[model samples]
Target: MRRFTRPKVIPLLAKKPPSQLPHLSPIPNPSLPQPPQNPSPPSPILTLSHTQNHTHLLTFIKTHIKNPPLTPKTLLHFLKSKLHHHPTFTHLDFHVFNWASTVDSYRHDHSTFEWMVCSLANTARFSELGCLLSFIVANPCPCSDGIFSCPRTEPIFRFAISAYCRVGRLDDAVRAFDSMRKLIDGKASVVVYNILINGFVKCGEHDKALWFYERMVRDRVKGDVFTFNILISSYCRNSQFGLALELFKDMRGKGCSPNVVSFNTLIKGFFREGKFEDGIEMAYEMIEFGCEFSSVTCEILVDGLCREGQVEEACELLIDFSRKGVVPRGYDYYGLVEVLCRKGNSERALEVVDELWRMRNVPSLIACTTLVEGLRRSARIDEALEVMGRMLEVDMVPDIVTFNCLLQDLCNLGRTEEADNLSLLSSTKGLELDATAYTILASGYSREGKKKEGKVVVDEMLDMGFIPDLATYNRLANG
Candidate 1:
């Protein structure tokens, strides 16, 4: 026992070697504050996401809602208040609706679903629309008492398909149309097919539109005027005028009378195909059918004839139809007037304007402005001033651009006094003078060697925060 003790004492006496000591981490700074063992919960994330839709919806409802227990009426009001006019933030409404579907406390009513679909469709959120439709189809509203049915479900699908066609998503539109048939209570309305046909036509898939029309006919859905019109327009756009005329005849045979739009489409098609005579014939035919000319019909006739260098014919047609009360009021006769003015026939332009004025169809400001510009260009300054006076008497003040033209003409002719008087008169008449007016006056003064007047105008410009360029300032300084 003594020998063993001596042997151990030889190692223990050296005081454990440095390598034999236990390794330990360095101690943290005692002056620094220690982190909390349990930190406060993170602030709720303010995010718009599908996964967090329920949480966000609850948060929004708590902030904006007022009723103790949410009812359809109160929820609808809350939704409309937030979503009705705010087109950009409509996704929040969808999120709320989605969250509402999960709750048994309330159910979405018919009006709510209709409004949501309309809002989504109108805003062109077709992808969201598709998802919404799927949700409605899969999980019908609880208000129906376990019946997964909606009266307006077909209409909503129809709108989505129509919108899809408008944006060139033909496949999605067709899929929606197909899905609609299974959901609708009765046979799909012709309006639904008409929408698809029109969409195909608008997207330039003319053959596909025609094919879809055939499918509608085969499906035994009674084609209406809208259905025939879509086909006619599509045929016309594809330059298949023969097919368009045939469809027009078929529309009549089927007892579906053509309206102003139908005739206008054919007439425009005729003009597009360089068949002006055919277009004119179509107009008379429209009258025989008791269809009054729409504004579009008048524009087509007048603008088409004018473009074909038959301004005189177009003018005569306009006057004749206007007197007969066939064309709508406010038809643009100025197109013909502008054409005459461009031909340096200001006399004819003035005559047309007077004729319209006598009929109590006062010319637009653009009409007066155009005539004044024409007169000025032809060096007929006196006539231009006369026209300007007429505009004022009619309470149609000249725009700044027209006023500036007159001022420039006067200054160029060394009539600075007249220009200055006109400026004062314009301001009195409520035409706010801009910096250009003052600069024009100053330039005129400088040109006429009126140094005092020029200096005063420049100082006014400077006081108004309009610093002239270096060259302009040097000229003003010299003046």
Candidate 2:
């Protein structure tokens, strides 16, 4: 109380100087409702109703959006969500939508538009794509930048071209591509050009593809791995392996490294053309390029080796593949087994069967048949019988050819009783004992000077509706 009463009410010190006072923005009107902070998800103006008859889906689509304009975006969405998803829908739906126009929509989103084009193109709906394209040409969508450019248009257009190409509609594809050129200002994308090239390639129109490829380079579109791959594959498909290899060299010369697919294509082409040496060499080259040989590559090598009577080498390769913890593909075993049997390498063929068994992979019907034939060819009658017994035990019926081969081998080895038992088994197994089987039995009896048995076999053969050939008749008469 001493100085409080008289304490001068000195002016309160300002917490912040007027010069340093934080400038406050005036608050906006709180009364006005704020616009939505985020955009609403787009609602489908058109909803699909399920119907048993697919024509109803088309009818529903047509009725809801009369004169519906088609664009790449709309087409893409429709294809992905509607047409592709509902494959049960009638072709009439595709036909109707294919012809629909996208002109009603004043502005179409570019990505959606591109997707639609690609979708239609993918489905081979060229006629419908063509109609939409005509609309685009007449009424180009305006650009936001006011430049009136259509960069996205080219991709969609290319998709249409590819579709046309897929259906062997080369003329249509060409027309679509040419029209696409008019839409974009600068150079079209290499990807687009490659699509056209692939179209040509697919139709076995290699010349056309090559022509377009040259044009692509001339138009400054850079060639890529896919471009070369398409050309190589096309060449190989046409059995023009020489031309394909030449192109491979040229691709490398142009600084493009050959990919595994490229090499694999070439190897397959060589093998198909019976250029086994070249195929094998390319396989080695593939390994040198640090590319692991695929099962297909291995199959080709094994097949080539077998064809050249190198069954031992083929078997070794199979063993090596197994040791590397690689299960031989079904084709590999089938090829090796067939060749081994054909070349009278039954022992090796049996070893292969065992190896496949050890690897827990069952031999194919072809492999089994080949093994049986090989055993018969090499006069391994007992082994052939063992294989047949195993086949029956495993619920596998011996094919007619395999059964005939085994019967002949048994008769030739003077195992007439076993051959007769096999005949009974064949009839029981629903297999016909054809002329070959009876001929073998007749020959075996004749060689043993059992005229009564040989004559009985001949009468049985005639009763079975098989007309014994001169060779069989002569053998029986001589006995």
Candidate 3:
């Protein structure tokens, strides 16, 4: 975490080591091609003071390695260790790395520079990070000499751009992006632009992202599907549906077919803008375009329409589309089913579940619970019991709330014996009764003045830590 300070120059009377070591001939000059070799272990370092002079540093490397003709691998290993172990002396690492790069026998590879940039970025040392990047831009790595140059440059700048943008240093990110452009062989690819566009959008610089997209278009860099998707998603987020639609159309005109995500975004936007019908129409259009429906499309259509109080329309659209094989199978329609039951149309809801069941679509646990509660609320206790039976048959266990509702409803109707029987039935079905279920039965017994039966229920409730209210105690006492 320490800032970079210029190391004071110390004069040395020792003779300067040859920039090219004299004795070793096995190590290929980096200026010439060399077959790859395994990297060697680092030289032991006792202090940073010995490394300030390139002469002493080169001699130190020559003398310390156990076995090496001093290949780039060995030199990189040595330098990386110093940087890794002695982070406080990173200022010296830059110099040692530069000196090693100057040696014809060893040049810094992409990994070396990348490690340096990553270290500087990770440490939040932006001043050194910028200087190192500038150095990379000016003096391309020796391996990046000819045909191999542009490809290697991409990752370095891409990493730099991502790192810079992550810290909210948008200006530095842009500079790195510009440097990346100058290094590529042909027109900058959509991928590089996508990185910058995504970074700008992530930083909430949407206008800047659009501006960069415009620049990309003007520069004749063709946008890909990802490019279109990012922009459309951004436009949709900024409430610029008009612009989003325009871009969607523009992408198609450019022979870039809209994908499912494109359709989903625009459709969701349509719903958000209160254009539910338009959103549905868009879903149909997507199907006609051979773009498959995703789970999100189903959610948007069903949730959007139901929220607008057109639950029946939403359900019908799904069933109708599903029958035609337009909407993808296996989309969770439980929410829609629950919404229907909640709207007091439990009979119609049950019918819908039957239809789906006939088509081999099993009801979800929530759908079963919703139906049970809805039937009880409608005073159709027999139908509620039938739904509960169906739930048990399907292995869809009812939750405590569902059990409580059925028991409370039975108790409310002066059917204490039936409620007690139902409680026993739920236990046989693995639906454990909670304190609320016992209290409901106990209260029901007290109301009927069945002192023996009621006293047993109250004792059971008390055993389960169910403290009855004073009213219930008085009723028991009076009974």
Candidate 2, residues 1-479, lDDT tens digits: the string is 01112212111111223332121112234466745655754221122232344346545455444433445555545655665556554333433332332223324445655655665576566655776676456545444224546567776787677678768888887888887777677778888778788878776788888899999989888788889999999988887888889999998899988887888789878878877768767866776677665667676678767776777877887666565544535544777777667666789888878776667666776677778778877877777787787666565677777787777777777777688777777677666777878878888887777778778888888777676477756655566
**Candidate 3 lDDT tens digits, 1-479:** 21133222221111235454432112234466657655963221112433234345455556655563456566567767644575454455555554444444344557777776776777777766777777676655655555545366777777777778778898898888787666566676788788888888888889999999999999899999999999999998899999999999999999998899999999999999999889989998998899988878889999899888898898788777767666555667788878877778888787777666667667778777888888887889988887787777766678998888887887887888887887777678888788778778877877877767878877776666665576766554445
Which 10-residue span in candidate 1 carries the lowest summed lDDT? 4-13
lDDT of each: 0.73, 0.67, 0.73
For this target, which candidate reaches the highest TM-score against the unseen true structure? Answer: 3
RMSD of 1: 19.4
> Which candidate leads in lDDT?
3
Cα deviation at 157, candidate 3, in Å, is: 2.0
Model 3 lDDT vs. the true structure?
Answer: 0.73
Give one digit per residue, the lDDT tens place, for model 1 in 1-479: 01111111111011222332211112234466756655754211122534344444455567776544556677688788865555544556765555444343344656666777777788787766777766555444443333344566776777787778878899988888877776555578888888888888888888898899889878888899998888888888778898899999989999999998899999999999888888988898888778988879988998999899988878777776656658666666667778888999887778677766667667778888899888888888777877777777777788998888888888888777678777777777778778888778888887888878778778877777676576766666565
TM-score to native of every candidate shown: 0.64, 0.53, 0.68
After superposition, which runs of candidate 1 have C-alpha atoms over 4 Å from their true positions?
A: 1-135, 138-149, 376-386, 400-479
Please give the clash total of every predicted structure, in order. 0, 12, 0
Q: Candidate 2: lDDT of 364? A: 73
Candidate 3, residue 38: lDDT: 56
Residue 266 in model 1: shift from native, Å? 1.7
> Model 3 segments beyond 4 Å from truth?
1-105, 118-127, 203-207, 326-343, 356-364, 407-479
Runs in model 2 deviating more than 4 A are 1-105, 108-128, 141-152, 182-189, 235-243, 253-255, 269-275, 304-331, 353-479
TM-score of model number 3: 0.68
Candidate 2, residue 327: how far the Cα is off, in Å: 7.2
